[model samples]
Target: MRKRVLDVAEESFQARGYHASSLGDLMMAAGITGGALHHHFPTKKALAMAVIEERVAAAVEQTWIAPLLAAASAREGVRSVFEAVAAELERQGFVRGCPLNNLAHELALADPDFRIALSGIFSTWRQALADKIASDQQAGVEQGTDPQRFAALAVAAYSGAMSMAKTAQDASILRDCLAALKPV
Candidate 1:
């Protein structure tokens, strides 16, 4: 039941902004009663935090971290992750944008707890990319690159492209962004 509630809440929160989505909406979508809902999550914030810590973080690990670890080079790893994400957007035919970015944009300023949680996720993501880049640099796969700066740039570029893609409702923005990231 707890997992069910979280699954529904994750979808709801991603589809609708956290501030705009209420417990009533989640309960209705999950087909659960108030008692049942509260039994698992004492408050909406709690539920959102759980979704961030569990679902969103796990998705990042699976989608980005695992691929990056297996990639032969930092550049290839970043490219692969971006290409995979772009392909997924094309497959869905709808760009809902990154769930973490969505929540960060909406709640980062208003809620400290949310800001902390989201920041942690971003830090983890950046660190993973940085570590991969550093490894590649040491292996001579990536020369003349500052792993930290490159990782930050890659993450920022992807986030900006995601925002533009979502706003324009065009998946091509992602492809273009990935193209820009490609080495000469």
Candidate 2:
């Protein structure tokens, strides 16, 4: 029941934009009625918070962190993670863009707390990648670059590149941009 609301909310927020999406619309989409929706989420902002938390956690674990952990070593993991990001962008046909980045652009400044929450998610993700990069170098699996800066740049590049790609509706442009990245 709770998951249903979160899922519906995530999709709604993603598609409709938080400001544009109404509780009335969400209610109809979710097949949820009145006080029942309020019982689970007292306010639309609370529901947005849940959506942000869940989506960030899922993306962090599945997209960056998981790949970083699963590969033969830290370097392979980090490389695979970026590759996965590219693959995902390509798989989306360069149309979907990024879920977190999209929301941050749309709602972050308009809502201060939402911006902070989104900022935290990005920070956590970058730090996690940085740690992996450091570990890889320390473990001698790979040797090169300042892990922290590299991680930050890599994450930034992925987000910015995806946003641009989404704007152009060009997957190859994203691929070209990603290919230009080297630890610098």
Candidate 3:
């Protein structure tokens, strides 16, 4: 029941901004009573936080972390991550932007709790990429690259590309971004 509620809330929150989505809407969408919702999540904020921590974080883990971890080189890992995401976005017709970035844009300034939660996820993602870069540096794959700076740049570029794709409703923006990421 808890997981069901979370699943509904995650979809709702992603489709509609957190502030715009109310408990009543969630109850209706989830087909649950107010009491049932309150039983699973004491408040809407709690539900949003759970969606971020669980659903959003897990999405990043699957799309970014796992592939990066499995790659033989940081360059390959980063390229593969971008390619996979680009392909998926192209398939989906680039309808929705990244869930984390969407939430951050909606709630980062308006709510401190949400900002903290989203920031933590971004930090974890950046750190994961940085760790891979650091490993590659040690292995002499990336000699002059600064792991932290490069990681930050990559995240920024990807986030910007996603935003542009969503605005344009064009998956080619993502494909172009992926092409730009390739080494000369």
Among the numbered candidates, top TM-score falls to: 1
40-96: candidate 1 lDDT, tens digit per residue: 899999999999999999988898889989988778888898999999999989988
TM-score of each: 0.96, 0.87, 0.95
lDDT of 2 by residue, 1-184 (tens): 7788888888877666788889988888888896889999999999898888887568777877777766766545655655666676667664666778888899888888899999998888888878877777787754767878877877787788778877887766555754664332
| Candidate 2 clashing pairs, residues 3+ apart or interchain | none
Per-residue C-alpha lDDT of model 3 across residues 139-168, encoded as one tens digit per residue: 878888888998898888878888888888
For each candidate in turn, give its C-alpha RMSD to the true structure in angstroms: 1.0, 2.4, 1.2
lDDT of each model, Cα atoms only? Answer: 0.89, 0.76, 0.85
What would the TM-score be for candidate 1 when compared with the true structure? Answer: 0.96
| CA displacement after TM-score superposition, residue 111 of candidate 1 (Å) | 1.1
